[model samples]
Target: MASSSTLSRRSLLKVGGGLGLLAAASQITPAWATGKGTKVSVNSPEQLLSLSAVDLSQAIRGGSVSCSEVMTAYLDQIETYNPTYNAIVSLRDREQLMDEASRADTELQRGQYRGWMHGFPHAVKDLAATKGLKTSLGSPILKDWVPGHDAIFVERLREAGAIIIGKTNTPEFGLGSQTYNSVFGVTRNAYNPDLCAGGSSGGAAVAIATGMVPVADGSDMMGSLRNPAAYNNIIGFRPSQGLVPFGPTKEVFYQQLGYEGPMGRTVQDTAMLLSTMAGYDSRVPLSQKSNPTSFAGNLDTNTQGLKVAWLGDFNGYLATEPGVLDVCEQALKHFNTIGGTVEAVDMKYPMEEVWQTWLTLRHFLIAGIASGLYSKESNRALMKPEAIWEIEGGLELSAMDVYKASKARTSWYHALDKLFDTYDVVALPSAQLFPFSADTHWPKEINGRTMDTYHRWMEVVTPGTLSGCPVANVPAGFDSQGRPMGIQLIGRNKEDLKVLKIAHAYEQAAKLTQTNPTLVKS
Candidate 1:
């Protein structure tokens, strides 16, 4: 005779079909997650929610805390704060989640241990499929669509013992950095409810910032992860291209512009999540075959006499709002205190050429994926103007145009590669301006400069994105209006760990994550 908990566990296994299969196939056995490391006991939900993800993991694994209690604290936090931020959508039922948590505890008691994320509550970005959960991508056309399968990263997260709570908000088809759409409305900045949360990872960053989730997975095509992290004052890491297996999608090679990464309140948490999300999958031929566990190891590294190239406004080629550069410069000073020299380096590469290359490639890739939606008049009517513009721009491009863009992109890469010969990491502002009003669509101009395109204001992020290198957005502190900003620490290609090391050291020196968001505090 089977016990009720045993029956419930079996039912969960059936419900998580592919997830359960993946979990069994790749049982994550990291020493950091399962060790009887820290006996972290918490008396109240506040204390439990306050502990870092790493600490919480150890506490749950060591039996100092139960998964039900952790789930309860997170659920309470979400119930209280989610309404205001709109960071999480398609939220799961509380009773069902509690039952899952109870089953997780039962498994622990029976000595059937899972991985690091064992019993952790997690939410996938709206752009990624969440099996049973609706992945609206912030579009009303697909608002009711439920994915039957999870994205590769989501599958890995499930395999690592994460309970899928729901989906985070993103822009329509993740076309913009602002996280508002016809489906979920706007995802407010974690620091200020009235301001826009940068997207398409806006909801993911906000969820982490507000303690709604310990960590989150996000994709960055054009500063999606970095910009939102900057807005919310959290760590958003864009790993080296191909470092993380993204999809088993139809178009694999052409979709090189975007890559999924992790966001967290701290660098270690970001690194830990990255470790789980990375590694090769035969389905995704471009995925790296490196050991993912390497990222989960010690991040503390000596930064004595390290050379950092500060690409401020690309020598005034970029139009930045007032104080954006000053804040980033001040944040770079932390590297100096840590024995790393931050030198302002003028990029000799043609700035306009790089922007043109980005526009061409972005338009081509977006159009390739979205042409189906654009073909339908009813769907086109429901789509955002930015989506339509990208499709149309791509439709207008010739083979020669794409070839020229690719050539220019290669040239820009070589230029950045040349700088890497002298500098260990290249630094730039993660965004052009601080968080703007959630009511506004996109910035029309910056400092009296006319923006030609909807995403022109975000041109500052193109250099890092185009380099195909590892980039981490570290908090650059707040402006006069208390709006947050961040600076991008871009490292040489295939040096994801190096970037994380520098970010961790700078984080220790700056100690910006010590400040919680106003929403969370209240």
Candidate 2:
């Protein structure tokens, strides 16, 4: 817990206060609530921390576990493990969080329930604007900056009665896949402290995997949600572009590449959080008008004849490291076991052209977002080379260049559409390689091919991102070195529930989420 206001006697006071408050509240337990009979049997901090987000939410709502106990359990868990892994940054003071938890308990006693996540302690990704909390996008330039208002998604989280405890770490300006920045150092992998935690959702995924937070909000432009979930052995869902209203920012319409999504240890928790985060907001012009609460509905579905197209390595166009494909292929077999047919599909469109289109649109967006900082010599000195490269690439493009890139993007979308016409979902490896060295920024080579750009190693994620479809990263089993990996299940546009249902069914069949890292216990 990195806090400026670390009180010497705070932990003892919090524990005593939480117990006193919970005991007093227990005397007046409501008849409608489950009281002490909830299915979750939490006898210790480890037991409480081990409960899934959905289970914890149910326990809190049923009056089985008071909010203060939940808060204290998480705070202690964070104190025990966060220093070693660096999964969470800019954490609020423990005493203040405990106070908020007590208030939540009082509200429940008065029958003022908020939502599914009522009283759940949550940490927003550092990229999103969290009112009154530090929104340092892991950059030293605005390290002390705090927003006065919340981002639209943050507003949703607060409205659902979640107590904002802290901000999860992210790459500076979310420019790269690996989560490291000059401001807060690096976030280590959940499975292994020495390996890289993929980002810019790296901290959020690690927090969920390590039980520091129940569920977290993360944004994805190029596999920010999927890659980290794959690396951490968790579930990350990237919903369709406009399903979650992104900004309530200056640039909303043109900047459609990046999207806000949910990541959790289970598919149900991810879908539940998505229900809270998504919906139509009049503030965002491009926001979809569908019912977001429907995502929280029952995920059970019959995939008896579902058609899945395995676009493995894009017919060998992508250069993957040794064992990634094998692990994902093994995971794909679970779909077959669940009565879905899997077939290897060849690419109808040229992959290189798709890559080129991604580069152009990404550069254009990055330049538009970061050009002001790039214009200043002092700021350029503080930025990473990859950020500079993106800005420069965007600066060099002309109107005609952007127009042509948009046309290419449309063609790629059509190509994906054609696939969806035949198959229910398209599958790919979430990452090209397993967890790599955290000291090294990004992989220079995969197998023998050199990566041309900082993000080219993660080009496998772009098709789902480019098509504005719903993509969920489901846990594929670990590699020989105990390094975890995941596979992406891409559904047709706006078919978020279909993707989640298949992911839940696949998760049940795979049984990989049952495995926990050693650090989670320690």
Candidate 3:
């Protein structure tokens, strides 16, 4: 087992005190509670819920707000809106959360502030283990599993004074992009209600979008964070792999493709959350020790002179929606306005080969972790068909296959490195299409092109995933049907802050973050 205690004093202080303190101190007043002491804006639940973490923090710090008030507001919204979305699978102890808020207020009175998240309520994805909370990961096999310990990220968030209010839904074992399982039914998009929230972090995005939580933590492997963020018109950031730790557990496959990241309604809040979440973890072999810099710091830097390469389409592998590309092109013009130059570039790598390689590696890892489920009579019926297929695929892979996949990944990384040599950032459409119908697993056709596999339609993310680059989904604009669209900004490895800076600049320039989803209470 990896040792949590192995974290250096520098890392501990960074996680426990540094950027976290700054984050805690910065709060934005809830839009609903401006000037008037009462008259809460339940009228615009979606707009109220849309307030970013930074906005909430600013609100709390202005002395016009209390932690309990924010918590109650969100809880009320959840009650009103989550029934249709089925986003929040399990809620935290409400009374305890209120108590924590009261204590935060007390601390403020004594001038002992916990930080930006001190009184803010947040939710963790069901896939994450939260101590004393039932973390089902949307699977029946773990229905009764209550972890005795919090995942490292969860503990870190708690220590930063974030209120743990609930667990959002996920697919069983996070095997699929759609957020539905026998355990939690289905998580729907907050914008359309009829569309599915892109999964496995679907519920987290929905929670943020629907006002259930101001911000939430989500894990991404195959577009879980980005897809959902795009679907819901929010911010989802996937930091470079190993920037956040993966374990003190036996799950090595998850350690590779899977990553715990932050999802929020705004980029600054996502940056603040990442500042709190990123740090050295002795328990996770891949976790990296970050420099003592706030993720939100240096965001004021101008994008002028920043070199960006735009991959408008991935060599025709995936079809692009016209509106999605239109918004992305408009966003690119902002880079030029700020003095940054944009160029069209071809990735030149064989995406089909890379897709197959990723599947082979993914199968091996998922199967290895789920090997025990292969038995015929160990209540193995609890597993989903997708999970079983992935596991069996992994079981069939040879050592040579794994070796070849790794080599291919190396080649792909080299190709990306060459591209980054000329560009500070890479821009792409976050998704090939806007939010599709919730009932369908994947769209049969998009932009007149038929997709053979549910996951194949989302191949645009492979470049970032395979390269382990820092990628963020920034809300671009809405499509014709009012569904949100996003543009992804990918930065060089370890330059997550740079990507965030660019995203923040664009967010401010576009002012898209100011828009809220149209909420319909069920």
Better of 1 and 2 by TM-score: 1
| Tens-digit per-residue lDDT, 1-522, candidate 3 | 101121121121111111110111223333322322333233343444555566566666656567777777888888788898999978867788789888888887787766667788878899998888898878888888999999888888888778888789998888767888887798899888898888889999988887788788998888788888988888999998888776557764345777889988778778778877889887776788885236744455645556677776764566887677776776556554455566666666677888887888788778777777566555467787778778888888999999899899888878777777777888788788888788876777788888766566777877788788899988878866888878788888888887887777767667777777778877
Please give, for residues 166-224, the per-residue lDDT of candidate 2 as tens digits: 98989999988899999999999999989999999999999998889999999999999
Model 3 superposed RMSD (Cα): 9.6
Clashing pairs in 1: 177-199
* Highest-scoring model, TM-score: 1
Worst 10-residue lDDT window, candidate 1: 13-22
How much lDDT does candidate 2 score?
0.86
Each prediction's TM-score versus the true structure: 0.93, 0.92, 0.87
